[model samples]
Target: MHPSKVELRVLGTSVTLQEHIRKRAEQDLGIKLRFVVQDGGSVQRDGVMHPDRYELYDQWFHSIDCLWPTHALQPIELSRIRRWDEVNALPRTGRLSKAQPAGGAGCVPADRLFVQADGTLARKPSERISMLPLTHNADSFVYLPDSMPASLVEGEESWAWLLAPELAGRVALQADAAIGAIDAALAVEASGLMRFRDIGNLEIEEIDGLIGTLIEFKRRGHFAGFWSSFAEAAQLMIANKVVIQSIWSPATVELERAGLKFRLARPREGYRAWFGGIGISRLAHGRVLDAAYEYLNWWLEGWAGATMARQGFYISNPKQSRAQMSDAEWAYWYDGARASAELPGPTSKHLVPVGQVRDGGGYVARMSRIAVWDSVMDEHNYLVRRWTEFMRS
Candidate 1:
């Protein structure tokens, strides 16, 4: 496994560490590609503490909060990426549409996109970046509307529903501290339980107050389970009878395959957004580095982006990916119009039946409504330590 072949090890979460992308990259780049896929927390930990183990890191832009501070990733030269400029304004300029304010909740991508001459990440664009922006999406909780309480109605959803006393013993949340806590904070605020000074970056007391409420809820048997992956999130609903829980897009599509009735809530408050991309390890150089750049550039040329779009993830460079998708697909997935015909996303077989519009709406509408972006708070270590009490209780 050494020397004879040009092998590139890419580390990331399940969101982008997909099998189809791996096979396609190997075929196109002519390099031995291996994706070390793990949960988001494990991926970030290994990437920061063990940079030499992988050549490229593929994960969300929020990762810069941890990886950049530790000097785990080298700057991705803007000149090296062929389609860098085509990336959408949201990640580059910090706003999806000019109508809204620049940047969204949490660690906004634009604020940390550039690597300044002084070697710090700031909003001012430079010749290099901490990560090559790739795929992204706006996420909200998913629930089975049919099984919900009469008081819980579709299109009138609220994050607070996750905390409703009626759903006790049947709710679930992701186990990750960063994401789980954000959703919990949203619920805590929405339920009139407590208000956060800053939901994205919780202070010490806020973390205590938030997690304390969650601990109480746990003791009351409000949460049915905690899921680590999309499949598990989907299964919790199917087998465990979890009627409502935080869920990813892939899991939503999987339920469509099973013919279940559900809705990815457009929470009245807004959405939790994230941007994912590739970054070279600081330890990478020579042939491995060259291959890493090749892989990064390949992600921008549209095929990989289009493939991910099928699963409801948006490519940073939307136009490039648009070319690879069919007209119906663009209409349904991007335009937010009713599907002219049957279509598929993030799966081999067709998933969307005729006349189904994408949940939330078009790209701009959904992205612009970000209530928070997935982020690591300033009190990250302490948050993790305290968050465990809620999970374990």
Candidate 2:
């Protein structure tokens, strides 16, 4: 490794900072970049336990809640970020401000985003923050159009379909406890298997009830498999091993690349939303620290955001991203207009055909209607234990 190279540990689900953007950042910033990609769990664990090993960590916002308490991250000076004002304004004008369950119960938690005098995190405004906001999107399952019964093809899609008996033995689920539990809870409620008081932060009893139902389904061979990574999820679809399952945007793009047909659902029960960002490790100093900040700014630059938008992601600053996109690309992606020409995926491969419209319409319309946020629940430890049992069953 080059002595000046900055080590960045990012989520596998991150499509924005892939090779092209990294290469561009390297050329433009005059810094050597090294990427260590992993699933969310490994990223979180390594980031918290071994901060000295990586200069930068890119992951979901919920990770701030998990990592901040441990002092694993450094306070990012707002003045240093090129588009700090635009980043701050995102939650104020965008989906983060919207209440969850869409008028049912619970408010979006108050912003716990600030830097403290001790170089730790705090909730109030300050000269610094714990993380730099990056790419975010809502998630839902996908299913093969041909796999559904004729009667269900034109009918409304629901999260309940994950647990529908007709799809039993042909369904898959995500293997992550936090995300998988939320998806299962939604399915349980939507399928009338059970209901939770608050699905976002499930109580002990609620977790037990949901996992119990899932275990029973698992025992009956209802699931084709469980996937731990986006690539695994895409492969399952490609192999036709599962008819319906939780899906990430990039996975759907991969499925399309394989010439497989899948529809990302606009579920009637609403979508699971997630927010992600990048944070510098507390261990970074001097030149390495400078490189980390440079990488953060480069992510907010328009080109990477445009790449992410190609595969159904929204950046904190859309203005910058929009500038890098063509008019037709902007219309087909952000404006919900039907594609006038065949559109490309994140890797610039043809995916969306002419006249095809994006599912869930535009960003504002889709984000405003979130059912739950991907979260580490209150009984997270217990949820993980029970979830492990369910998976084993």
Assess every candidate by TM-score: 0.97, 0.92
Candidate 2's TM-score reads 0.92
Off by over 4 Å in 1: 1-4
Write the residue-wise lDDT of candidate 1 on 41-69 in tens digits: 99989999999899999988888899998
lDDT of candidate 2 over 1-393, digit per residue (tens)? 353455454433344447876777778777777777776777778878988777888877666767887888888888998887776344433344544324212223225356768765545568887787777777899999898877666789999889888888899999988888888889999988887888888898888888888888888889999998888999998988998999888888888788877788999988888777888888888877877887889888888789889888888888898899888889988888899988888766688888888888887667767787777666777988898888877
* Worst 10 contiguous positions by lDDT, candidate 2: 101-110
Looking at model 1, report the run of 10 residues with the lowest lDDT sum: 1-10
lDDT against true structure, model 1: 0.87
Candidate 2 wrongly placed segments (more than 4 Å): 1-17, 92-110, 116-124
lDDT score, candidate 1, position 140: 84
